[model samples]
Target: MSGRAAAEKSGAMTGANEFKLTQGPEDSVSAVKFSPSSAQFLLVSSWDCTVRLFDVSANSMRMKYQHLAPVLDCAFYDPAHAWSGGLDNQLKTHDLNTDQDTIVGTHDAPIRCVEYCPEVNVMVTGSWDMSVRLWDPRTPCNAGTFTQPEKVYTLSVAVYTLAVFQLSVSVFQLSVSVFQLSGCVSAECLVRLALVMLTRCVCFQGYVLSSIEGRVAVEYLDPSLEVQKKKYAFKCHRLKENGIEQVFPVNAISFHSVHNTFATGGSDGFVNIWDPFNKKRLCQFHRYPTSIASLAFSTDGSLLAIASSYMQEQGDVSHPADAVFIRQVTDAETKPK
Candidate 1:
């Protein structure tokens, strides 16, 4: 089959041949993740304010636990516990096999994102209040908090995005790095989030173009510093006029673990993979029907899982309509030049 034909046959929009894993409710899945171990368990956070663990081999729920607020995100630690954050501004860890949960730490504002760093045994939480907090997972306590300037307007509240990584142990020393992105003010915020570690130092790439009406100006930051500085280094090259108009705000970004590549998914229903070092677009996947809210790469960097949402309106009530899609990223030469 041709590339397009193969994509359509493999699932695309019909959802007929797609490997669908339904949990909670048809629309409740907010985030879906695979464990970092060899077992490859699937963990999901839902709009029902709970985190559900599934044994993918059996396609069954192994465990579920409720949180203080809607569970926005969940990730597994290296050992066995799962870490989660949500609207309650608290980070909670749960042991799936034991059915126990403990609040590890609290944020000053609604928690928007959570990630586990196994190399450092740390949990990172981002908040809508413009700050990212780091916690010790073993102790369930705050290790450090990175704060940003407060917004002047309620609509301008900073929603943070975070990524953590560890530098390779070399002849020098061992170091752990945390990267964060803050100050997003767009209907479809496409913030580029990444952690590129050299031998001893790490650099974070956070990019979101500032906009007046709809036009955007990009900004960059390195989170390792005490005073986070803006680099304003990159610009979005207009690929196509219609594409530019359709460049929905970016919702989630993931970097290739082994290469200089990264992918950005947006509300515009497009996932663009780029080479950050060369500042070139490698491939574009544009088959999504809604805004891509979150993304994850398999530990081996072979597969990508995307969480997406569509807007729904009922009388006066407004809620996000969501779904998950798993895609395989192929090499550049394998795709059409």
Candidate 2:
């Protein structure tokens, strides 16, 4: 085994309260999200064309369902219902109670993000077709479709606001736009900001955007000039060795529900917790075996699920095995000092 693999194995064996999922995805994991109401169940979507429901308490996969193509993202509509979209350009809902899958709708291109808005009781999907679609989860029908300036890359909904990140016509730039969701599926464009190469986004009291250039930006939803001035961007996930610097993509972000602090995972195989409100980094964990494809903190912020999967970005290199790790977190590591 390579030295890096040996070091990772040693760390996994010694890390406190950390355990690897023995029955992980066959291909790269695209998303890992916990149940909205409970931490015991986890929802995982993978490039293997499967979505799995795992019982973390029992450390076993409860069940799994298949798709025609690789699943890109998945969300829990409720405790027993899951919503997923994929390269097949199809939106599907799985009924855990009955082991049934229903085709909700289809996009013009591969679906990139799937999210459920509890406040509006709507299921929102973003696609590379350059459109955002809203669905009525109960009826599982398309409520509306809104065109975007470019291909939708990621989506995050906070309270009444929805933030959508898209690739710009310029190959080097990304556009970040925010929308206000009114009654049910009604959406109104609020603001648009341009940045460099966005890869992932997450929204809470405000919005946090990560770029392929190893940087992260924190922006607010308010339109006031003073409120907007508080927005700032910083660099991370870069290393300097032998008089050269290597930069990696920041792939995932998950917020701690109770503390409002957030964690970011990168291709550098590192996870760092930050207090965005205070502009401070709380802690940085030891490196994993490979890149972090996705991350999710349990509803109560007591556990964090890390998806360490190789993204094949380096081309024809020796790739590490894909795996998922569950770690019990503590207040000292997540809470602001």
Candidate 3:
């Protein structure tokens, strides 16, 4: 395997030198994510049509499930059950302990991505059918579905790119914060932002907040009905194409837990960071030989874990598979003006 050495500067370290784990059942891997608890556990989705959980510290497999179609994406609902979606047009949940799984429901088209709310039992899925569906795994029924314009598969294709935050939850009601990208024609079009409110009765209230295509918006959800009355939004910047312009679609997006930062990667073979608070590009790193499949930030936002597929022509003619890179993000020094 040919590996590039990232500079040893304060903010740069060899992401390829971090902890590595190999997951085998043979299909191409689509997505891999770390739990909110940091390095404790990780969830992975594969084209082999299954979701596998790995013990990061021990580099061992804890559990696995067969979703029946190429499991395109997976996300943890907590640390226990994971929500997985794929070409089967089905949304399913897998229990990490029992190694059991059930099909919650089906979508009109293949489900491309799934995400769980940080502070609640709700989950949302994006699909090629041009709709985002919300579900309460606790109920195993449809909670809500947000429909977008026709020919808007970009939103669904980018669904794995979705992010969620809790707004509020009470004995009677629950509120969630979510955003999606629209109007992406190719690489030049800016992604438009659509923010929506989801309630327990399966009601959806959506509104457009911005028309920038590649940018990501984030918000904190209030748990109380009263606090849910306030409006807030943050934007994430995309990397500028200064070198070769490749048409790799961005597959995933992640935000730092405590910092006003976020990261995005795509088939373009680069991972870029941004300050969500100020909407400024922080820095960019490129060393992956293939498309970036997924990204995760450590609990303290100190380490970044990246999963990528290996590209051919770069060497390693045998045993071609996916690789993971871990990067350390350092704070910049302040200089007096």
Candidate 4:
């Protein structure tokens, strides 16, 4: 990190400290992702039915993209060109450069997650309709689809030094290319008619899936039996009450851009950073007053944007209001705690 950038990252806050963004979404903001190419830029998706672009340094919303319904998740193909999926059951690409929005795909039910793997050169979208589809940016038509055995809620994708990754594949190829990770679960809305899986994230060589059951499942890509052999699962985001274990749904996960590390947030009202390489927690944040709906690490690994918001059954008053926090993360903080 450059001196100026590092100063902006940490400034005078040596101990646990975070800077609040200016004006934030009026409604619960469920997702906060830093731009892939720059740490100063970020995108926020919210129940307010809008996706706003912001300059992290300025803390100002520079642009707003509206959808017919609440946006569940989003991914940037580039700084200007990105994809968003929402309750409208539509996946649309919003081009910041031209300010043009194009609807490229539709789902039988609402789309739950959207991800882009640059190395593999593909975009994946998962929906409640029990399907995940892959698309080639070169064309609007879906290049492939993965029909899950159960209703799908969330997913993620990663790339490695494989010869190539293709969506259309034989049984053998699918055994290698198919990755079924977890998704995001919002804690703000009522859970009466909804089953939630809100977010997932692509880790180093594979992906991490977080569930309402308070578990994080780590699995890798194919082609290497050893990598797959290292796959494992663990319990997290849980609390004990009256000698009984009460589990909270995992709401979001964000990988450190440079640290080979990742963070998981849940309704337990905490964000835990982990070094999966060592199978240990680097740090745990306990300042949030409510469930953590979303998390994203900046491109340089110097900053993390956290959205602590309400996402539960309606009329719940345990927590109210929504806000975003930008914290400076350093090597010292990543030390085992």
- The numbered model that scores best in TM-score is 2
Q: What tens-digit string does per-residue lDDT give for candidate 1 at 1-337? A: 3322443544443333233333433444556667776334667787678887765434346788888778777878754788887778778888876889888777776675666654455666656566656677666678776553331011111224343222222332222222333322112223323322221112234443321121222334444564244333342312357544422344456656546366666546666776644555787765665656556666666556667665231233555546666555666611323
Ranking by lDDT: 2, 4, 3, 1
Ten-residue stretch with the least lDDT total in model 3? 199-208
Clashing pairs in 1: 188-249, 189-250, 190-250, 209-217, 210-217
How many residue pairs clash in each candidate at the backbone level? Answer: 5, 0, 10, 14
What TM-score fits each model?
0.63, 0.94, 0.63, 0.77
Best by lDDT: 2
In terms of lDDT, the poorest run of 10 residues in model 4 is 185-194
Q: lDDT tens string, model 4, 127-152? A: 77767777776576677766654444
Over 4 Å off, model 3:
1-17, 118-120, 151-249, 276-281, 310-320, 328-337
> Native-vs-model 4 lDDT?
0.69
Clashing pairs in 2: none
Worst 10 residues of 2 by lDDT: 1-10
| Candidate 2 per-residue lDDT over residues 1-337, each given as its tens digit | 4222433554543365677765779999999999998988899999999999987766668899999999999999999999999999999999988999999999999999999988899999999999999999989799989999899999998787788888865574678778989867699998888775656655555778887788988878777899999999899989888989999899999999999999999999999999988898999988999999999999999999999999887876888889888888999999988
lDDT of prediction 2: 0.88
Which wins on TM-score, candidate 1 or candidate 2?
Answer: 2
TM-score, model 3 to reference: 0.63
